[model samples]
Target: MKKIAIFAKVHDPRCLGVAEELVTWLEARGLEPVVEAHLARHLKFEPGTEPERIPDSADLVVVLGGDGTLISVARLIGERQVPILGVNLGSLGFLTEITLDEMYPALERCIAGNFQVSERMMLKTEVTREGEVISSHQVLNDVVINKGALARIIDLETSVDDYHLTTFKADGLIISSPTGSTGYSLAAAGPIVHPALDCLVITPICPHTLTNRPVVVDAGARISIILRSMNEDVFLTLDGQVGMELKAGDRIMIRRAEHRTRLVISQSKDYFEVLRTKLKWGER
Candidate 1:
């Protein structure tokens, strides 16, 4: 019997209902259903089942909530090299793209060891002040260095592969992976890149000069940003979940992380189908 870790958002009825159903289904099939602590109270689950417990014992991690919840759990199990299946119960989800109807079949394929695993890239971001490394973080999405709401426009000096790129006077900057190209990068007028591509996109937020457009960089290259303004409130955000404050004379670096997130995709689905369904592309 394969041990499966079940995680969901308790606030959503759809997620809660699905979690309960999955627990019963897994148990009937002689599989152990391990749920996250918070979701335990919502379902009629047996005692002594938790996320931490299952990650060590389970064969797979099944996340039934939105992208944010999945991201949280993914980070919790980071570098464990565990495969995760995301079922979307929220809106505009890029990570949690699987539908409710696809749940059981996906699980069945996992149990049968028949599925495709997409190795999505992650980013490692580091912040330095006065040449001293202060903070570091890992993000599956883009790394944004921008100014606060009340702060004035900021100046950022960017470089790719140690080669100086154009400086930007804008609200902020976004450095995103190909998998994250459809996210904030797309909203910032950046091109949408297929997830299979190995590339990084750099987009400026509200550039003062219209000539400064977004640029796509090679994935193997290193990206560096220098905070040129001495009197502005700048900040660094990771996957829009974690953030750090930036000071003048501070330098920020971004590169491909050593670890990757293994996402299980349905054999019947394609990336273009996801784009069309989620984005309503070419629709009147």
Candidate 2:
């Protein structure tokens, strides 16, 4: 309530303008508005705070962009329990559900501590090569393992909790948290799991076997995927934002994170409403 952080997608001019307006509004109410160093330069303010420091310094983080931008902030918050308010600059977003018209009202409730906070689960993903951990990332969405454009169908020998599951011969495999059910997992014919459920979904992308279907597993399950395809340009993408090239013998491990992302829900709408608006339910 005292120190507020503002982050916006610089690609959209409207987001930047709204961020500036938010700064002024927050300042007028005797609140300190701290901005990221890169965004501060664009807003004509002196740079003092870094993006990583937002979680530590700010009481609340207001994001002005789509779900992608909010996802980046979620990763930064990483176990910090800070609540994030996402304002959709354009159309209705899955994660960024709050609209421009409802921003101030939402902020008013948030400032007064009268708002509802929804806690969504996160995923801990890592890459291991030759029995050594090479890379690790915390994601609010799914962990994707796919091949490059030039590569053919890759093999992913997957398992759950030390049990051998199956070898999926497909273009990719999506290991998604329940909160990420509406994302790439849905596009790959995965089930739309409710965010409240603590579970994981494994969906194969364009599988060679028609019988290979998406499977929903317990949240405590640890998915171990071993890349068995050689001479293929395989990749491991995290939350559709950051990616890394994978070798043939590399191992991809995914598990439920210990912490969750606390999101400030839209005051006027619910999750079903969001699905209806975004997916156009009951429409011809």
Candidate 3:
């Protein structure tokens, strides 16, 4: 890809220096580097492209930060199908598996058109209030419906393909894609599903019923949940980034989205290798 877009966590002090070097490196190779507006401003560079407009012109996107940063970019580039290279500046990350030391080499491979990409499924979430659609979002990771700290255990009436399931009495509920199995869902005792799998995971956060367990379903299944807890502080979060407060009668619809996020695989390591390293597996 000739047009490379750079997205960085501008809040980090190290990002400025690394972005400067990256820009110079790309220029020396006769490649065009497009910087996100916020990062470009931090670097004190002239006019930069806005985040929304980057997908229209960029052939590839390179995100420099933790998994959170990469996840936000994935949402921003909805339906574009552009490949993303995630470089972690700090500790190991599930999504940003590529380390800072391996960044340049990975870019070289991408520039040479010799790279592999993993197609990760996304989720489409809609909120319906009083028979009218209020808001909709596309998320690469999990969708969380949670109760406020002061609120008592909330009830979530869940279903699959219009079939009534159980009404979950818990602190919250998480609906995640296979790609997001390692995220919040995993923390709530959800399964660690392989990214290649086409499935959805439903995990309850601190359920009232001890037997309540996480459920895995086909990706094609349409899951629905309604908030049954009245006059309580309930919220719906998308990828742990953005969200909205939920009402008593709010209905949530979640399903696999038509678009998927394409992540460039790190040539230096495989998925199991990442898992072992990140989770400290097999370590005494």
Give me the candidate number with maximum lDDT: 3
Clashing pairs in 2: none
- The alpha-carbon deviation from the true structure for residue 284 of candidate 2, after best TM-score superposition, in angstroms, is 1.8
Once fitted onto the true fold, the runs of candidate 3 whose alpha carbons sit more than 4 angstroms away are none
Flag the better candidate by lDDT, 1 or 3: 3
Ranking by lDDT: 3, 2, 1
> Candidate 1: deviation at residue 32, Å?
1.5
TM-score of each predicted structure versus truth? 0.93, 0.98, 0.98
The alpha-carbon deviation from the true structure for residue 275 of candidate 1, after best TM-score superposition, in angstroms, is 0.5
- Regions of model 1 farther than 4 Å from truth: 44-55
Clashing pairs in 3: none
lDDT of 2 by residue, 1-284 (tens): 89989988977899989988999999899999989777888888776489988899989999999999999999999988799999998564899999999999999999999999889999999899999999999999999999999999999999999999999999999999988999999988899988999999999999999999999999999999999999999989999999999999899999999999999999788999999999999999
Scored by CA lDDT, what does every candidate get? Answer: 0.85, 0.92, 0.94
What lDDT is reached at residue 246 by model 3? 97
Instruction: Provide the lDDT at 101 for model 2.
Output: 96
Candidate 3 — number of clashing residue pairs?
Answer: 0
